[model samples]
Target: PQLGGPIWADPIHDIEFVQKVLSAVSTNPSRFGTSKRIEGMLSMMTEELPDVPLYYALDHLCSTVHCNTPAMLQFRSALLHAGYRVSMSHASRNGLKTDAPPGVIWDLLRCWEKANPVKRERLSETSPAFRILSTEPTLQACFDVREDANPQSRKRHLVRFQENPQANWGPKARAKDSGGISSELEDKRKLCQNKRKNQVTDASQLKNFPCKRFRKGTCTHGDKCCYSHESASDEADKME
Candidate 1:
């Protein structure tokens, strides 16, 4: 019935259409473009496909209470001790994803408070911390660092979290009618640029800082490492 080219009589679903496009591009590579061009097209199209759901579900645990790195480590250790799988969530730096129940998590927090001892005057009677801490822990939560508490991502030194490429790098207000950034924002950007570079000019300024990994005997970077591998007493002696 169609004259100029092929025409579709029936409607195709979104997923089905995507699959059809993928199949057509893959089968007729020469018709598209050069090898590199076709490869790029395929890659871009492939990214549009829906991601497969994870086999095991993870419960996101965003803590209301302030927790430093050591506190977070202690929490992870406690969770591991309680026979629950735990890992740092990409959603938040301080947040953790765990399979542990709400009760278990609350019990662990109570145990941490008992071990660290928060000042009674600081916590209000109506506060969640006070309400949670008042109840005795149902499970025995240990704060001791377990071997498995440190995740593989940290051990591997993978680039999991990205540092800001430049100061004031996030979303900005729409450009002015003049098609340029505001004067205030531009001035702030200029001031922040090379801020870190200017802070430490001399190489010696970085030295004598004790490497935590080296102290723990887990540092893979040997003598070439910039951080000092010497003990605290040795560093003190060096200072003298």
Candidate 2:
């Protein structure tokens, strides 16, 4: 005898499993209404389904350069319209992972630049933006949003890229030693401060006494030597 309760079936080899499950739940509301587990399972299956590939094939598109005019949504829409699969990369908040070729990506960027014009005079001929904009796109790009432009994860409100847990959460400055003691290097730096500026330049202003190191032929300061390098005989002649 078949049970009266919900009969769970594995959606093996069923490409429309998600749609079928949703339909069944909607039609037989009382059967699934009492079960939170069923609801959560369906949610997970629909929204949390990972996009896996046999191998790493998608191209990563990220840049440190401050070109924020072309939003991710705009790029996604354009790529979708051009019949290419595109998604946000986990590596960066604004990064894109797509199967689209470099040429097509550049073309889309060119289209975006044309619509939202930038200061042409500011861009140099050698700059990437200028070079990309100079060339005409091979394919005419449409920024119209397609039904699939927005992924299921986004639509279901799944946590894609997590926000910063706390304010200013990133790389910090080097930690100082405990007890607020200044380091030996810092003490040495303080001692050496203004040493070059305080150095006497005029030979006449220098002390007539010869440097002991200069007499021993071991003085390293050369012309910048603060002490006089004159011999005892020269000093005696000067005294005379």
In model 2, where is the ten-residue run with the lowest total lDDT? 53-62
Tens digit of per-residue lDDT, candidate 2, span 94-166: 5555667778977876676677667778888887667767889999999877766666645766444555767
Cα error of candidate 1 at position 11, Å:
30
In candidate 1, list every pair of residues with a backbone clash.
Answer: none
Model 1, 1-240: lDDT tens digits are 124545443322255565677567668867755533443433333332133211111122223332222456777888888998776643345656566777887777666667667676787889765677789999888879887777654564544455577887787755677789764577557767887885756667566577899889999988877777888888788789
What TM-score should be assigned to candidate 2? Answer: 0.44
Predictions in order: lDDT = 0.61, 0.61
Instruction: Give the least accurate 10-residue stretch of model 1, judged by summed lDDT.
Output: 52-61
Q: Residue 76 of model 2: what lDDT? A: 80
For all candidates, the clash counts are: 0, 0
